[model samples]
Target: MKILKNILKIFGILGILFFFWAAFVYFSFDKTEFLKTFQSRYSKVLYDRNGELLSVFLNQEDQWHIQAREIPQRLKIAVINYEDRNFYSHKGVDFLALLRALKNNIFLNQRTGASTISMQTIKLWDKKNRTYLNKLNEMIQSFALENHFTKEEILRLYLSNAPYGRNLVGFESAILFYFDKNPKNLTWAQAALLAVLPNQPGLIHLEKNKNLLLKKRDLLLKKLYDKKIIEKDIFELSLKEPLPHFKTHKNIAPHLALKLLSEDKKQVVSSIDKKLQIKFENKALEFAQGLKQKGIQNLAIILADTQTYKILAYVGSQDFYDLENLGQINGARAKRSEGSTLKPFLFALSIDEGLISPKSILLDVPTFFSNFNPQNANKKYYGLISAEEALQKSLNVPFVSLLQNYGYEKFFYKLKYFLDFKDEDYQKYGLSLILGTKELSLEDLTQLYLGLANYGQIADLSFLRDEPLKGLKTMFSKGSAYLTLQSMKNVQRFGLQNYDKTKIVSWKTGTSYGRKDALALGATPRYTLGVWVGNFNAQANANLYGVSIAGDLFFELLSLLDRLDLEFQMPQDLFNIKLDLMSKYRYDERLGGAYTYTLYPKEAKILRTSPFLKRIYEFQGKEVDSKDENFKDAKIQIKLDLPLNALDFLHQENLNFKSEKNIKILYPKQNLNILLARDFDKQKALVVKIANLKNEKVFWYLNQKLIYEGEATSRILDLKPKIYSLFIISESGESDEVRFEVKQ
Candidate 1:
């Protein structure tokens, strides 16, 4: 009895001494070093709006650090129940567990570790050689950490630094790497599997030791069940749950993910709808694959919300892994010619300025302004077409003429100021501006389309969740925008007249010169989409055209959106007015009159009546004296061979008409072909008449040769049976020529 008492007293004294030593060490330990000692390199994570994991950006060491708040409550309980149940009750070190470990090692001849969660965290903070002294040091620092932080903070520190298999550290990286999901959204079984990973990360290979991992996970789950931490049903279900299969971590939206990650290691929430993005990506891939069979290799798409201007889907390329197609390039951002895609905006501008209305007549015939002569896409002239028809047909000649009428300087200013076009772009592309000669990114073009959908308001796009909504600027008046959209709705694929009405898509298609790029831009009441299909290498493919390629893909994507039920509401500011068609027509009695009425919106300021309607007459005959009784009541019919505008100008000036004698070709006019082989020419001498002759000698030349000379009101020229270039010259140096083919 005395020996027992003596042994107990010595142990009591040693325990007191150890307690005091631990207190002294805890006080002396530098707690500030605990935070600075272990700097975890975290991987950047991108999440969707639903807190679903979209992608993960791995750090150099393949770790992801997360905050305590980000840790799910269920995961916290699973980890604590499996790793350290007494984590919260104990300060830092659990002496009871330590004694139990010592007893197992000594008497039971078994090895067990009793390191508390706090102590493990301290060890992770300052890795040291495994020795008695190092363990002592860890215990001391663990106590110090307990004094400095709460239980949750210490647990977070453990989780942030904990290592899982395959050199991946932290709960975020490990769970995401293994399960392909965010830790917060992990299933109970998944959480249990992750709880046992840190214990044997290096040794428990997923393939080689998967069963061992499963066994250990089941055991931990049973412990939870026995302790009532988890229900019996959950425990049984978890036991039957299969271990997570290893999944290759993918960086979806690689370009955008890398760009966001480059700035910081923190998790970023993007407004992108991952499901929609995946759908668009798949469609782009499928489309590109179909095109690749025809040597076309790349496609990009952008879908944005009309109201908020948020980009919901963005596919930079068909496939990021396709190196041969240069699929890594973000084709959505690359600048290329937009072809006739810009015509709608130009027409809108014209309509907004009240220069033209949707029904205004625009000449689509061959036109020349300065040295620039633009031809129609099909090289066919449609003499007279309405403004809406011109835009629907995408007639280049009409838009070029409209742009010229709008004045290049004003249009350039509007493009620069309203749409943010650069000055260099204006200088680079001149009259071809309406033809999309200047290059623009898909992002910019989509925003412009958004403006059309939003009653002419343009706003910048938002990608990040917390980004402030940009203010909208007026790009076009509500009336003009509505009219433009109305016109675009009429545009449809050839032979598919009712497709637009069925789809209700206000869309436009563009094929850049040489067929290097094909684009389709469309908008519903709620969404705007832009698609580009072409070779990323800028190789021209004749098979690729706007309506055939990009437009087809656009409609396919639209079907995925399931927004066909939506409809565009007409703006309240627009009015429908009916006017007399005759009031708008220009009437000229001469030169084979062709009359078409011009229409204008009710709000449009009337500039002037159609110049073609004004009439001016020029009569050529013997001079008539006003005093003569026969000429007093005479009404002379005259023919004017001048431009309509010139006649309008002459009428506006109220100029008096006087008959003058001159050497002029009355018969066989300019560009007229006279075939002598016919009996008509054989019976005629091809008489050439002159007005205001003033007794001047007239010289007639055939193919630059003087064939006849006479002073008369009319001269006749007879030539041998042959093709002749005939020229009639007056002594005043005025001359006219006609090519006549004479055949017997």
Candidate 2:
């Protein structure tokens, strides 16, 4: 009875101590199964109106990962078979497998792994790398993990916890690396291949060592076959299968992905219009290939929706793919400058300052700055053209003139405020901003163009769709934006402004000395294009300057986009002045037939000319009452006695009605003089000679638009106020256009 009593006491003490030990382990067990850095680096993603991803921004220094459920079953099964076959039936440690491993390591003289799949998982999740204390901690954590998770859950943890190589630490990434597909659709053989990578990843990179990969694949197949996991025939088939040549799209910014992958845990939907993306890619590829055929090896292209500032497609290079190149890279991560593509913004600024209007004249002449005289593209000037003409033709001199006209500091301040750029940012590129001298990037260029496309508002360029930020602003006014758009259109003019009018294309071409520094910034009603063609090192200089070459390609691509309803919704807010002129003064009977007058800007009525031309000499008829300074309500009816059947040239391009083919009527002096405005220094009194009835000749002066046909001298006629060129054309096919401005 005493011995039995002592045995009971011993059992009680062991039981009590065991209970406390178990409780201690449970309390101290690490609940953290895995430590993954926050998924993204960027705070938010940029999306289009349709919620398409324009670009993903990240600032991380690690690999991107998908979740366990995000992976495929093939990978799951492959990982289990290769790493832990008894994962489904075992607790924290597979006792039977452990016993066998211990026997092999301690007695059979081999370093057999006693650590269960759970232990490996624990190490992956909570413990640090190889060390005695780490191993012990892994054991404790693994045991605790088993206490809470089921066998199946443990298997899942093992699958997700395992490192897939290349700093990608899970089944989510293993699938991406080897198969290029998500884990769910992973092939059996591909899964087997991923299973083999755990032993040694780098040596098995088939690109460098195909033989070694085949060896590892064969070993995996043998292990599976011996275990009866796969049929004999399946095992043999797997061994015979060759490695799929692995290729990857360079993760230009993997960190960018985390910031863009999700918004508030909701998976990101991109603002990337895929349809537009395909169109742009196909077109860019076609051009890049064409250039390659001609010895140009690379092309960088970006397609964006101008209206919403959504980046639709971007092809950094022609088949120029990589996996790890990030930061300052397009084709393999080399960033470059964005040239004349920056002009529209400056032009936009000009509009906001009211220093110029779309119709205001722009001079393409020699414009001097601090010892810098930027000339027209070809060092030739196209005399006094509208602001619209200067932009379409990409006249540098005129842009500089505008900058000078509107205080330079104020102009830059406008730019900085609108673009959210600092003074330093502008000083770096703005010195030559009047010219295309800024070394910027494709992404930056896209942002600026996007602002223009967004009706003068600049939206924050983001990679993530969520996360509130304040970056959007009306950098310029609607008027400025509208004017800028008009300027980029295919204008009706001479020289480089000439483009196929039928295409509805608006483009600005830019080039620097190096062939590598060429860019064509253009946009249509649908898309904006920024193409950079260049190389790394100094090769970019020459390779990039081929904008004209790229412009041809750009139009070719734009043609592929579905034809949209791009008809001009005429500017409703803008008002215009219209003049209805007539060459005919003679009536069908005597008082000249009544003419219908429909003017564009219904505001203009009285016939007005430049202030200088407002002074008319004397009347041709002595029988008529001469006009006076009080001719406020005065009206004059004059006649021209020309031979019948004589053809006459009428008003400008769209001719006005023929009031009477004989005489022109003038409004009262007071009313007419109100609209009189001009450049008095340019008004030249001309002489005209007219031969009347009975061979009598008289001399009179008249305005050019109202040429007397007869040699008239010393006469003035009311003409439209605009810049005009004096073209003296004789019978021969020769005429000289001498430019002169009539400001009225």
**lDDT winner among the candidates?**
1
Where model 1 places Cα greater than 4 Å from the true spot, the runs are 1-40, 62-69, 90-111, 125-157, 181-185, 418-425, 495-501, 576-612, 615-744
List ranges where model 2 is wrong by over 4 Å.
Answer: 1-24, 31-69, 73-120, 126-157, 163-169, 188-299, 305-339, 365-372, 424-432, 437-439, 465-470, 491-505, 512-516, 534-546, 549-744
Clashes of 2: 66
Model 2 gets an lDDT of: 0.53
Clashes of each: 8, 66
Worst 10 residues of 2 by lDDT: 664-673
lDDT of 2 by residue, 1-744 (tens): 999999999999998986786667557864542333222322233333354333322224465343353445656666677777777776666778777977897888987676777888776565366776676566666778888777767666566556556655556455555566535556567778777775555565656677887777778778777878789888877777778754453332222233355544524554455456556656665776666665566656776665555556666665434222222345422445555566677777755554444555444533334335466555667655666677777777777767676555665566556555544555554446656564556666666676776566777654322334348887766556655766677532233344445666556666664455666666666777777665544354333443456566655666666543363233333444322122211112223323332212112122231111111222342222344553443444433322211112122112232222222111111112223333365443322111122111322212255343332312453446554433333222222233433344
Model 2 scores a TM of: 0.56
What tens digits encode model 1's per-residue C-alpha lDDT throughout 1-744?
999999999999999998898888788777665565544355567776556666665566544554333677877888888888899899899999999999999999998999999999888777777788889988887878888999888888888888877767788766776777656678778877778888877788576688888888888777778879878777787778777666776556665665565533357787788888888888887877789888899888988878788888778889888888787898888888787888888888888675577776676754444435588777786656778998988899889988988876677777666567655546556788888777888877888899888878888777776777785788777778878887898786763443435567788999898889989998888789999888878899988888878888888888788666677887667665442243222233342344444333444444333433333332344434566555655545333233332222233345322323344554444444454433455553555443423446878777887767877545666656666676777778877666655555
Q: Provide the RMSD of all predictions against the true structure, rounded to 1 decimal.
A: 10.9, 13.1
The lowest-lDDT stretch of 10 consecutive residues in candidate 1 is 640-649
What's the distance in Å from true for residue 142, model 2? 4.2
